[model samples]
Target: MKQAAQAREVDVLVVGAGVAGLSAATAAAWSGKSVVLIEKSDTIGGTAAIANGSIWIPNNDPAIANGFTCDLESQVRFILSECWDGFDESQKWCGVSKETFLRVDRYVKSGLRVARDLTNTRVQTFTQLDKIFKRYFFSTKDSVDSVRQALGPNHSRSDDELAKAACSSWDYHWENKFNKVPYGKHIWAAFDLRLAGKFFFSGFRKHLWHIVQNMVSIRSLSSLADQIPNLFTKFWGFGSGLILVERFRKHLDRQKVPILKRHELVAVATNGDRVTSVDVQTADRQTLTWKIRDALIIASGCFSHQLTGDGVQDSYSVKSSCVAPGNDGDAIRILKNADVQVNQNPRPVLAQTVIQLAKEKNAISHEPVFYFYGDSFFLVDRHGRRVMNEKLTYHDRAQHHVGNAEQEFLFLVCDRRFKERYWGLGIAVPFDQKHMIVGNNESTLHEEIDRELRDNDCDFRLADNFSANLRETKIAFNEFARTGDDREFGRGKNAFDVLGYMKPDRDHDAPSRSMQPLAGEELYACIYGLSTFGTHGGLVCDEDSRVLNSAGDPWNNLYAVGTCAASFLNGHYPSHGMSIGTGMVFGYLAGLHATSNTKRL
Candidate 1:
């Protein structure tokens, strides 16, 4: 006998409790509608909880209200530059004219208008946030100095090399926001959107502690003076998503909204391009059918790990993504089944830290997804050659790792001094050294080599397929110690990297702007494998986040947001938190749009 699905009804059904889904559900509830928010994971927040939680909303109202400069034209140009890859002017919108079609500029404008009106409270929190965040860039001493050297008082602002060389060290985009609809395509690198509210909403205390602890060395005196006053007026949570989640979740609760966690969305019941209901299998294996009375909003995340099947393997297999496992392609599958077109969009190279587990396992019990290892770190291939610019952006580094032949295993070499400071830098938040190789600093090189005689066949111990790597690593260590540079690989050249970051090293002249340890710090190396942050692929949707059919018409009331839908940048990573920002804005739009259907009836 086939068991029957227990039927229920809701004004709005939101799948996924990630930042996007929560934003959507919250928006709908705010519209005076009953909303249901669900997550496949046991807990809320999704990957956003573990993430650094930086949301990049350019030209945001908070930034504007605070007198922060914004270069919207530059941001839009950069966003659309990559989008023009497969674009055909003759069929720019495929019969949807530029005036009526969701042009990227207009699309952004609409989202900004909605964001300003939809979440005024969230916007207020970021005012203090921008003040705290602005200091983080100025604290780094070297890159700013480099910018002065590269761009003299007379040089043109359009120098690309100077921008790359500057390593995005300064807040240069604020130089003149009043400038014309900027012709610059790479200006996003210079702008700080100031919308990364998680740092303010939650990480403020930890950040203050971090700043206070490092005050004598690298912290900014002025930033501390400017920000301390604001702290007395506000209370914050642990991070960006949690505080908002607490707020949104509470609002939903008061509105009689039921949030079903441990419920996996299984199938969508559609009728003539409209979603009629959603079938979800609960943690108890009970199938519950949510009959949509008004509209269905799919805020499920990207097709990153979690669920597996035929289609997902294609994108995720090429490069693995790092996010909560709950982001299976449920929304992608549902919409595809309804005759919607899904693009398996290819993105530019994104860098991610490829860590090799000691147990040859997939996950670490306390993995630090956001923080990078320190100034002493550098990656080496099997041949013991350095990888290019070890400190480039995580996605940039990850892209290089994907293309590298020696990506299966690379040595993550660090000195004892750098190792000692790992926890402070958030290398692994709530740091745990459960699977580390600690070389002896007190003993001689020969004596230390003797201690590794009984080494296991772990990747770290025998990285080059040798019986043991003590001899190979010891030689490299000595060379790096004496030179204070990786001459073979030019390792510390990126301004974005901690190693390359210029500190006031009065001890050595250091021929270039990059930094390195004085040597003899003792080796603490680990083998790492290439990893990804997440994949950007899924069903196609229009400006309002409405699911579009093959003929380019909206699918009645079905909508897709977050990772479940393709990124607005066409899978390309535009800046630091573009993914989260776009998802939230679109999710906000979807919820508002879905609820408007009720008003029409």
Candidate 2:
């Protein structure tokens, strides 16, 4: 490891190379401040590199060609009125600066402009389905009762309960029945509800219901309904992040920002309420201390077992999904050790569930679904007896079934129908099952599975007898579609249970209607051991991106961003693009603030 004899000085030292860190470094360097960015991984992208890369800039964004007549106050009011019920009263009225609002607006405009330019030039495609969906389906009342009644009474909750929850004060008008509780709160609620002998009720139902309703609503938005698929592809399909990251990276490179990869922060040298220097370890085990004369920004990320190799550490643990493996809680610990005031209030609104299963050869032959950031993964038996909810944050999901010592194995049951519709059976494939030789390296699918099993302390078993399970799962799904009862697990058994609350509003009369048109007989199941997404919890910081001491004051020369910084979304993991947006916006704020402070000095 090489050591510098003379101390290096920088305007800012950004820890972590994820979205937040990159954003901060980019902004700071662009602002004419010398900056140093460090990352534990050799790669600079962090989890965002693998992310779907959608930033949820609601209401009017740059995507709209004709400028809207709406003002920021009006727009903010409209959004708050629609989504406010889920927020605390204080947060509901908390006004965002006009500058911040405009920045977001400009970002939206830039994003849309890039999309349009790319699309016109055939680099990419852009679609505005949300507008289209709103235009066609302007109905404000979101009711699943019709769907429930069509399914059957046994599969669903009483119309009265559904209406009560839907119409209650808790319902945010725009979000419909979706509650504002943080993700952590929701997961804890699920665990508590389950322990109390509750069935058919869980947060998973609410989340899925929200997605279904949103999808249906988005579909009804415009006359361009025919183009909806293309729009969705533009937003969620692979390589979506390429445009955004590429544009941003270019901008930073032009500004001469220094991005240091594969470096981890070990300690902070502080001078009473301010950070003076940061000690970092590189991939090669070399340690370097960089002195910051102006400010230090921390965007490390939340602490999690997978990310930090540390177990659950707080009440917020329930809501955290796994993040990148390199995300340790060092950022938070360092700040806390410096006596920064942090928000330790229990987040009780977040909820999580995971499912685990294996794909048959037909389902995934070309592209395998990569699990990143610990989103939910569900493994359902033929009867949809959820074998696992793999998407939830690690601790909460693991605790659900870890106690069952006899549960040595779980199943991921899939049929020919599932394979045919979602992904072509011939092209979709898991990385573990492919046989290929590339760059002088030869590998086989079976070897990959064996290695994975061995590393995770488990074994994989293929089942040939999936016919019975498929029939049972199909029958249950049919029942659910027709009656909304979820007879197998009582999907909507309780009003407060997160899952139960999301019971599909079915048409009770159509109890025998099949949800899927494909046959289940040809499906197969693969069993594998489970793993976590990463970890959550990091250094606590305010919206300005300044690292806060335990006393709640900003560490004068320190700031944090990205997963390393405490999240603004709290516990709820919104759509794919939400976090990236948060990282970008906050990072920008931190950079601007840090640079301004530097100028003052």
Error of 2 at 444 (Å): 26
Which parts of model 2 are misplaced by more than 4 Å? Answer: 1-7, 66-174, 177-236, 305-323, 333-336, 342-412, 420-473, 479-514, 517-520, 526-536, 597-601
lDDT of the candidates, in the order given: 0.52, 0.42
Tens digits of per-residue lDDT for model 1 on 65-103? 433334664555445554446443356552333422363
Determine the C-alpha RMSD for candidate 1 after optimal superposition of all C-alphas: 8.3
Query: Tens-digit lDDT track for model 2 on 1-601?
Result: 1122233777677777776776677656645657777667777666555444555433323323322122334333433333224433245234543323333334333333323332443322333333322332221333334324323455444555443323321111222222221111100000122212211222224234433433443322331333334322212233334444554555555655666677788888888877788788878888888887777887776554332112333222222233455654666566556766454422222222211212222111112233211001124432334553332322233443333433333434333322221221111112222221111111122233234445543443223333345355556555454564545444333221222112221222433212222232333333322233333245666556666665566667677666555444344333334456556656666776788832311
Model 2 reaches what TM-score against the true structure?
0.56
| Worst-scoring 10-residue span by lDDT in model 2 | 182-191
